[model samples]
Target: MTNERRVLVHPDADALVAAVSARFLTKLTDLLDEHHEANVVLTGGTLGEAVQKAVATSPMRSAIDWTRVHFWWGDERFVPKDDPDRNEVQAREALLQHLPTAEDHIHPFPASDEIEDIDAAAEAYAQELRDHADPALRLPVPRFDITFLGVGPDGHIASLFPEHGVTRDGQDLVVSDEDSPKPPPRRLSLTLPVINSSQRIWMVLAGTEKASALGLALAGASPEEVPVAGAEGRLRTVFFIDGDAASHVPADLIASQY
Candidate 1:
């Protein structure tokens, strides 16, 4: 069964970063303790990098056996591996490289330089998911303990843009977007189904510019019109926003504690 969505508003961007970082550490430890292994799907953006950097400096970061954890990307720009625009590049500089995480355990999408094209790269990632799928998940993916997503002001999540029909239909675990409304044009992203398959989905957003998108998502907007609205987790779904982003969110939807 799917779970209802919840909203958590932080005082500001800085508070959002600290709160999320702390919550991440706690969730990681809990998942590791309960399952012995944890798979995390990470996002990329200024905020995403900020959270990673915060986790790197966190006092509780060392408590976990990083080797037991597997890190995955929710989506990636199809760029050269060494390109500064690549999410993995910023992520490594911010956190993953600092952890003792096993090299084989970090699953980044195939870079443009490493593969033929976006389609090939997308399939490569899909195969990687299949390779890591747990039998019990009953899906062609791993047991994603937590999937972190950064919502665009336009309400897109991952590379699933609302402008295109990218969020509409696909059983493929991963899909390639060759003409993204945003930069770089090409990208690879996990489908909404794959994202929703996770145990928990954390949608992180900030800034007053995101207020409309947040309000629409919570107002039951169609996925095709607001992709973020369609994203949910089997166990839990949460919208973690800052005061600025929550400007249009209803008072009742805002949880004082989560």
Candidate 2:
């Protein structure tokens, strides 16, 4: 069964980031109060980076025990660790550096130096997930309290593009490609099954470029034709979008805030 989705429209980009950051802190604090630890899968993109920066600067930044929160990336550019385009690099500079966390808690994708190739990196990451996942959960990945994601203009989620074979390749936890439609062609991403296994999924969308894609996904488009349409959390899925991105959504599909 699929989880229900909720769309929230903010006034602008900054507002969207602030709202998400605050909500993320609240969610983490609550989860820690209940379980004493939490795992979050992060995304890397314009909005993703922005949200991290917001979290670093938020007044509530010191509220949670960052060391107990395990961080994982949903996808990463296949480049050296220090490359500007690398998701792990950007995330560290934007947010992780500011938090009080143990080095072992940061689970970045294998960099070019650590693997023979992108495909090898994917397999290594899959192995890491399997090794760390709680045996009791009976799931391939860890218990992701919240997995944050960003949608591309073409309706792609993570590295899964429209009609891509990887989107349907359930056997693999992660997939790699050296010829992506987007730049920095080579990349690695978690498969749909791994992403959907999360307890909650938060999709952050911004700008007019994402408007049509959001419209199509929310309009019951097929997951193969619009990969973002298949991204759903097991317990709940929430879309935090700016006004520009929410513009194309049908009136009946959006909440009153719009």
Give per-residue lDDT, candidate 1, residue 16: 94
- By lDDT, who's the top model here? 1
Q: Please give the TM-score that candidate 2 achieves against the real structure.
A: 0.95
In terms of lDDT, the poorest run of 10 residues in model 1 is 163-172
Off by over 4 Å in 1: none
> Per-residue lDDT for 1-258 in model 1, tens only?
759689999999999999999999999999988997999999999899999999999999989789999999999999999999888999999999899998999999999889967898999999999999988875789999999999998999998899676554567899898889999889898998899889999988899999999899899999888999888898989898999998899999988788
TM-score of 1: 0.97
Question: Candidate 1: what lDDT?
Answer: 0.91
Overlapping backbone residue pairs in candidate 1 total 0
The clash count of every prediction, one per candidate, is 0, 0
Q: List the residue pairs that clash in candidate 1.
A: none
Residue-wise C-alpha lDDT for candidate 2, range 31-140, written one tens digit per residue = 99998679999999888999999999988989988989999999988988889999898899999999988988999999987786888899999998997786655467
| Per-residue lDDT value at 168 in model 1 | 45
